[model samples]
Target: METRQCGPIGRPRGFDADEALERALLVFWEHGYEGASLSSLTTAMGISTTSMYAAFGNKEQLFRKALERYTEGPGAHLAEALREPTALAVATAILTGTVRSTTRPAHPHGCMGVQGALVASDSGREVRDLLVAWRDNSYSCVHERFRRAVDDGDLPQEADPGLLARYVTTLAFGIAVQAASGVGRDELQEMADAALRNWPLT
Candidate 1:
């Protein structure tokens, strides 16, 4: 006897994964990782818990994917900023980009990577650690770029790449926090500009 071929699996995932992921990213952006409940996430994604799990594994896994989307979307400026011709330009671009990304109208305020996991409970430890690594990787990239600037004489011989990187990253983070706290984009941009006025801080 010959067996009949089955059409496929369950319901055809009646939603757009890309669009759903974007919705999830906004929820995570608006609320910290721990703060975004399954209900909220699924509601925002316009899916059920079963659909979320079936499509993205679990909450943490969904969060991981959302973070990836954040990096590629709003957080893409860091990579582009690193390509600026001079160290000062790099610093400027990073800060400017941070301010803009964290304060866009019709979008969640603040950096997701910064606000997503600032504090975590016992169960959220893994997510907290993941964000730490995300931030550390960003710092490392900036440090390396600044180091190259020092070697190229773009920065003075006395300039310290590590210190400079820390300074810029710190300002970037500060801008994010301020943006989250209702700080205006213009004011933050002015502050960022002043902070870089005396660049290559000896």
Candidate 2:
């Protein structure tokens, strides 16, 4: 009698995929796309070269998966920020979350989405483009939320949701850059507080 298996039978992965990808995420977050070598990623992820490729396809694909993990896990506050009750609350959530995430000691300082591929090489244009698209989509989501706020009378009807969205996004990106440059969390939070204090309101 012959026994059969459901999936392709290969050597069982010696690493926990979620944990390895999280390690890879941190490596990419710290080093950026062009800067992170396969050696560095695989070493940090505790996987061999062949295993890394077999598990995640290639470096680019691995980066993409790690990035997805980042936004879904450590970076999930971005999506949650838009769920605040009022426009001011939403802005506050975003700004506050940005400072916290960017300046936290556990993860690398700054945003993986914003700084991950800021200066990629030509060969890394695809990776950079992916990051850019993710950021742009996030901005669009914020803008739509702000637009709904206006319709719901949370923000003034005359408020330009697009401009407002740009303002908040710009502030978050700047905070990320500063945090990456060793700025303290308190300083960035002060900035966020000040920005919300002067918010355009009804």
Judged by whole-model lDDT over C-alpha atoms, candidate 1 comes out at: 0.95
Off by more than 4 A, model 1: 1-11
Which pairs of residues collide in candidate 1? none
User: How does each model score on TM-score?
Assistant: 0.94, 0.94
Per-residue accuracy of model 1 over 36-149 as CA lDDT, tens digit each: 999999999999999899999999999999999999999999999999999999999999999999999999999999999988999999999999999999999999999999
In model 2, the worst 10-residue window by lDDT is 4-13
The Cα RMSD of model 2 versus the native structure comes to 2.2
Candidate 1, RMSD to the unseen true structure: 3.0
